[model samples]
Target: MNMPRPLIPQVMTTPPTAFPARIRGPLLKLCLGAGTLGLALHVFAADPAPVPPATTTPAATATAGAAATPAAPKAGAQFDWSKVPPVTAPSRPGMFVIAPSGPGYYSLWDVVTGNERKAPPVSPNAPYALMTNPAFEIDYRYMEKPGYEPDLFDPIKRIHMGEDFLLSFGGSFWYRYMRESDARLTNTSDNYHLIRSRFHADFWYQDKVRIFAEFLDARSFGQALAPAATDVNRTDMLNLFADIKLANIKDGPAYLRVGRQELLYGSQRLISTLDWVNTRRTFQGVKAFWRTPTFDLDAFWVRPMITERNQFDNWDTKQEFFGLWGTYKPMKGHLVDMYFLSLDDNRHRALGRNGILGDSITHTLGGRLAGDYNQFLYELEGMYQFGQYSNQDISAFAVASGAGYHFKGAPMNPQAWLRYDFASGDNNANDGRRNTFNQLFPFGNYYLGWIDRVGRQNIHDFNAQINLHPQPWATFTAQYHRFYLANKQDFLYNAAGAATLRDATGQAGSYVGDEIDFRFNIHVDRHQDILVGYSKLFAGNFLKATAPGVSPDLFYVQYNMRF
Candidate 1:
């Protein structure tokens, strides 16, 4: 029963969701763009403008009025943090705000200091303050009936206060609503709605340590329009977690403190917790980070939070997960990573846990490497899994690998990826298959392209994509996907009929099938933006053989903004 959602008959027919209350699109965009432009100009035209000399000696000043401008700093040197100015309080005229008291020591003009100037004072009057503004945004989407496909477009708004102690400590707020056009064949068109909202905040104790947290909520309406469709309007517990980090360590390199946090490895093709769905991937755990001259290493362990929906059916069962990941950048733009991960499944028996009665224990070992060359980014990864056989003696293995290339010029970056997946299971064995893509994590949901050639379960997928950044604040992306059965011989003509493997050879063989998706994102302002998108899906002869008319088509769009 643990199958990919797309493979589930119910999900395939389910319509996509829609956004919340509509808003003025054009006016909203104009306001946001103008705000960003104005802020940029202000930063460039501040009073007492600090302008350094164009050249070191200026070929001996053309006129006596010229002062010896300081030499330009080297390009690849570390940024100086000492020159930061001090903060002042309105109530106490002579008092300085937020004096240095925490982990990392504070200094002004450190970002660009030379032997001549020891360091700048940490005062607002010095130069610039380490601060940020917070913002929020929202979007709503919808579609029509019949095909139950999607037509997505919505509205959004966002805002942010300057990054002062109060604003920074309060975090940020965001809300999004999407009405999907697809739902299973229950004929529940326009009946599914999803509302997501989150409140985030961060607290810094001293300069070296910080605490971050977010409260997320998501609700779904299956068929609120129909009194009989109670199944359509259920609320979901998406995400609720907190995490902290300790940046400067007095004795050790650095100690990373984590509670409930999200982690992403290399390209994420083999290991991702899809956050785009609104639920966002999360795990309750802790981790430590060690940084040395050659590399940085992270190690952590976690367990399910056991929210209402994800609670284990059997409370008596015990489950635990742990992992160790490390990254080494021998040179700039080159990163290599290796990890050992383990997850215990108390819900199902391991493949070979017991001798005669023993089931198999699921285990995965994987590693990846990525590099940036000029404007091109590339990723290479591989993973191997071993454990349990549904019906046979001990013997099962799974392997996965992925590669991608990104084009540089323009915002429309072109990229492609190839993935090969193979695992052990009877052509028809039904063991516990892990859902690698369903997790609620932004790192998991983001893809280089727009196809799920590997739409969950035990299927092989090949995918590719192109990203176009035509407008300065907007991006358009497209993707294609193809699917195939792990083994062709185990296919059957009909589930109801008693036809054996031999009689099913007459069915069409597994082959070409693909899905295309297009998406556009526009930045309305520094704090807000809008998104629009659509997709078309098709299945070739290969999918037709597995089940008649199994492939379905769709289109969707949504707009979002922050205030």
Candidate 2:
């Protein structure tokens, strides 16, 4: 019985395997090389692998005596998803675009979405609650070169947290440290650190009513003079403002907002927040903004606020200001704007160190026009500010204009613009007119040598910029700037006798050599990006004074993340 069972194994049959030794080795090598080459290509080219479009087309059919035909729509203006870009759930109901570099290197453009961009439509019956889209950023940068002292670096961040409603509240904070280099202080290297913060709130009521308020606090710490130590610090240079608005009164559509608010009118060459510095220059008075279907109007009365002492009392007391602004858009791509301003400072004295006046009124009026042609964008803006102050009771004025263009046919979307600035203010040696890229009053010179000298005086500047976008998530830019002083120093004589005043430097019309700035950015993921930039400040007499024997050159790299 045992021998019978063992004989059954002899009849067992084996199945053939799928793998063949003849082709197995070549197939394995082919797949491995393909994967390795694909990885190498990906590593060299930053572009993500292209994605194929997903779409479905209607089927075609043949008729008895007609060529193949497709089905026709039962027309009533149906929605066409194919004509629009694919849309995911929108992140929010507003547009946010941000780019950051080193310190003083940030661009923020945020606007409440209307019907454009297919923003979520307003529904009266929908949920009523506060919804906001907030973002923040921080950057650190440094560069190394021989001879020059290592540049002082600091932290910069922007805070924009607020709910869009009848009213909104939020603010931004900033701090910086400027270390005077081994050389003396010429604007190049100053051993001073500035810390500043601001808070603002805006509210709209009854669909047409509005209110606004803002507060600023700042501190400047560091050695006013080197080699020794002293506690002569400056603190709490506070600025406060408030305003109210009334809209759509009676039968006609009109509105009015009165109080303290920074008047940002037109393109900002004339009146702007001057956001370059930490503490912003705010007006302590009232303003009216009226808008209709075809035209909009903006007018204001303001007083420059510098110190916190009697902050609200001296606001519009010595100087009463007024402005009338209007804009008209008759045709598509065409816009026209004009403004008239008046400064009534009766008890006007000399323009003080902080740009305040004792007595005497001044008047400023200007206008601007902008329009778009086939593929070109053009803008023309000019404003004149005239006022009387000082012992001579002299009159000073300023003018600014600019134009820009875009080349849609360019390989990499390209845009270029040119601007000219001519402004006049205090010319005395007093430390007034904070020379900053962002300033309240209309002063020129955004890119001063290492030091900025366009503050508190007469200045003229010419600037140009070109930008290229080779990819949707990357940009490259080049900018050039030059400046010159227009005011000559007049002799000043004291009652004690002789004279102690002379405009030796600026009198001959000081000049700041042309500066070149080049920068580029690469957006990695959705919330992060990298930036690289270089700046060369040509040496000028004014620059030398701020930093003797110093050639200002800066190179920086930074990574930014937003949330």
**Best model number under TM-score:** 1
Instruction: Flag regions of model 2 displaced more than 4 Å.
Output: 1-188, 191-204, 213-253, 307-316, 345-358, 385-387, 391-397, 409-412, 424-440, 443-451, 455-457, 470-476, 487-510, 518-536, 541-563
- Each prediction's TM-score versus the true structure: 0.56, 0.53
lDDT of 2 by residue, 383-480 (tens): 55444443334445555555666676565567677766655634553543321111235312222322332342355668786767564345677778
Question: In model 2, how many backbone clashes occur?
Answer: 28
Cα shift from native, residue 346, model 2 (Å): 6.3
Off by over 4 Å in 1: 1-191, 207-210, 222-253, 256-258, 270-273, 291-294, 309-317, 349-360, 374-376, 388-457, 489-508, 561-563
Give per-candidate clash totals: 89, 28
RMSD of each: 20.1, 28.7
The digit string of per-residue lDDT tens for model 1 on 1-563 reads 22111111321232222211111232243235434533433343332222221111000111111112212322442422111111111110000111112222122122124212222111111111101111110111011012221211111111112222111321222333333332221223443444445455444333244455555554455534542211121232222232234443321244544455544443444333333444444455555654433344556545544434432111112444555555554554455666555444444443321222322233456666655456444555555554333233333344444444555442333444444444332342333342221111112113322222233323455666555545323445566656554455333221111222221353565553566666655433323334555554465666554444444433334333222
Q: lDDT of each model, Cα atoms only? A: 0.35, 0.39
Candidate 2 versus the native: TM-score?
A: 0.53
